[model samples]
Target: MNSINRILIAGSFLLLAACSPKIYGTVQLVDANLQPIQAAQDSPQGSIVNMINTTGSIGQSSHAVTVDVEGKFESEKEKVTPGMYKVEASRIGYATETETVEIKKFTGKKIEFKLKKILEGKRATIKGAASDEDKIINPGEVSIQPPSM
Candidate 1:
């Protein structure tokens, strides 16, 4: 009787394990120039990565994770189920980006977000003046001043 109970328990455990699928991926945040954004120590939550399982009902299956200092986020081990996920990355000063991905395995898929900087109010561009004997100013020598309220 004891041996039979042990065998049944083992089979049940195996069945449960087989039913659960593992899903994971990496989210990368970058600027318009394709430069990686690193999180500052002062602002720990540099960016937010929200994953919604679009395969099923909306809002019911959603997960939100914060990116690390390297502006990267990975799903927890076996925490996410295999399905179609709509991933979104957002930052305070940058435009939000979204992508629809199918996460079916545990492979570390890389998703990159190119966020454009949002400029508010007016922006002034000042060009550098020519100096010395050279009457031509250096090209691309432009400075952007923050908009004043």
Candidate 2:
């Protein structure tokens, strides 16, 4: 009976330990107008979501997951502890987005991140330059000629 009581206590502790909170969310890659970026092909998969536990030790409290094609992500069951976390989402050609959330035991929190596209500088082009057949003049080889009166 004594050994059985000890086993029961141990099992209860195990059950409690397995009931940690979870964090989930979606990371949408959007344009300047806040519209979802449509992929040329259906299988675009480079987005990443990270949850950093702000109240815990560094390196040990960071969790990361790759977003699906539709930008959905979820933490593993009972993988995250109850605490405050800083969630960040990022993808190529888009600016990273971040939000702070509090995780509670036996409950899940959902966060949404809308990333904006990074605007690139416009390329300079010389349309009618008399140099190459391509008609575009390289910046380093540009020559200004005075117009004949």
Tell me the tens digit of each residue's lDDT in model 2 across 1-149: 69999999999988876666878877767778887777763222668888899897665588988888777898876557888989888887888998899988777788888889888889998667566675765889988899989
Q: Could you tell me how far off, in angstroms, the CA of residue 50 lies in candidate 1 after the best superposition? A: 0.2
Which regions of candidate 2 are displaced past 4 Å?
A: 1-19, 41-44, 124-149
Return the TM-score for each candidate structure: 0.53, 0.65
- The residue ranges of model 1 lying beyond 4 angstroms of the native Cα positions read 1-45, 57-60, 105-108, 123-149
Question: TM-score winner among the candidates?
Answer: 2
Model 2 steric clash pairs: none
lDDT of 1 by residue, 1-149 (tens): 69999999999988776655433344454555766556441332457888788885654488878877555576665556778888888878778888888766533446766665555768799876567665655668967789999
Residue pairs that clash (backbone atoms under 3 angstroms), model 1: none
Provide the lDDT at 126 for model 2: 64
